[model samples]
Target: MEQDIANFMLRAAKFEFFLVNRDTSLVHTKVVGVFTAIIGVNWTKVAQFVEVAFPFNTFDFTNSGFEIFAQTAPQYLVIKHDGRLGWDCDNEPIDSWDRLLTRSYAQLRNNVAHGNKHQMPAPFTHDRTAQFLPAGLALMNFIANQVFLESDWDTPIFS
Candidate 1:
């Protein structure tokens, strides 16, 4: 029931839990290389998914792309809307969909792995940590529905 293979594949692929206590900085800056392993900081896949889900990249980037839209706001919540269109932000995300398409998880990864890693800007502080865990776990299950739920793929992720 532990699903050792599943766990190994998850870890091997470089996906980290980034749990608050153990390795929270993976979400931002200040990471220990050996621990982050292979997954690196490239959220490109997630960003790509976001773009497909919300193609316009038209969300308000007025005050740094760090703003988290309400959970009810599907248009902004799902995609990586940062780095698309902004001037006052601390870092660069892709701009046009075409640019985002070519953007890999480079800056954060490159900085952390190669040169001096700058401290990242402020993080998402809105949600409760308790809520964060279940949501993330649900996301994992969403991707691995077949593997985790077997034929019951339609079952609710958290429920």
Candidate 2:
């Protein structure tokens, strides 16, 4: 798990590099392949992992202009939706900011993979890549922390 997390971080860095030098569609497609493995199909572990820091009231989605969540087919929805990406959610909408972030990421991956690029969500779009990258990276770090509590993840990679 530790090595896998490290590989994910390295792949994320590569994603940024490609975003800088390649077309947006190409970068999106490339990232989908690796990121999917990291997030996995089931989200129960992610939900349990993030329970350590839920609510996320300190993180303001409105101010950041990222909607709490985005779906491919919101119009077909009603009240009480189940979580995706392997989340065994009850008949309730996603309730936490972290889960919302993962869901948004999953939606983006789906959009790219399933040829639904037109349905890509706000924060996951190429235009907002700079703003969204930090949050995604932080979430990746959170996963790493959950897997190996002994590691000093608090230390900055750069000064």
> Who wins the TM-score comparison?
2
Worst 10 residues of 1 by lDDT: 70-79
Clash totals for all candidate models: 3, 0
**Candidate 1 C-alpha error for residue 19, in Å:** 13
TM-score of 1: 0.26
- Per-residue lDDT of 1-159 in model 2, one digit per residue for the tens? 234335445645543343334222222232465563232333443444445554454544453333434221111111334543221223346556445644654443343233321343333333433333344555445444543342344444464
List runs of model 1 lying over 4 Å from the truth: 1-44, 64-93, 97-105, 117-159
lDDT of 2 at 65: 35
Worst 10 residues of 2 by lDDT: 70-79
What digit string (tens of lDDT, one per residue) describes model 1 on residues 1-120? 124333423432333332222233424344466564333433444344445545535744333222222121211111145644211223354464333322312221222233211232
User: How close is every model to the real structure, measured as TM-score?
Assistant: 0.26, 0.35
lDDT of each: 0.32, 0.39
Clashing pairs in 2: none
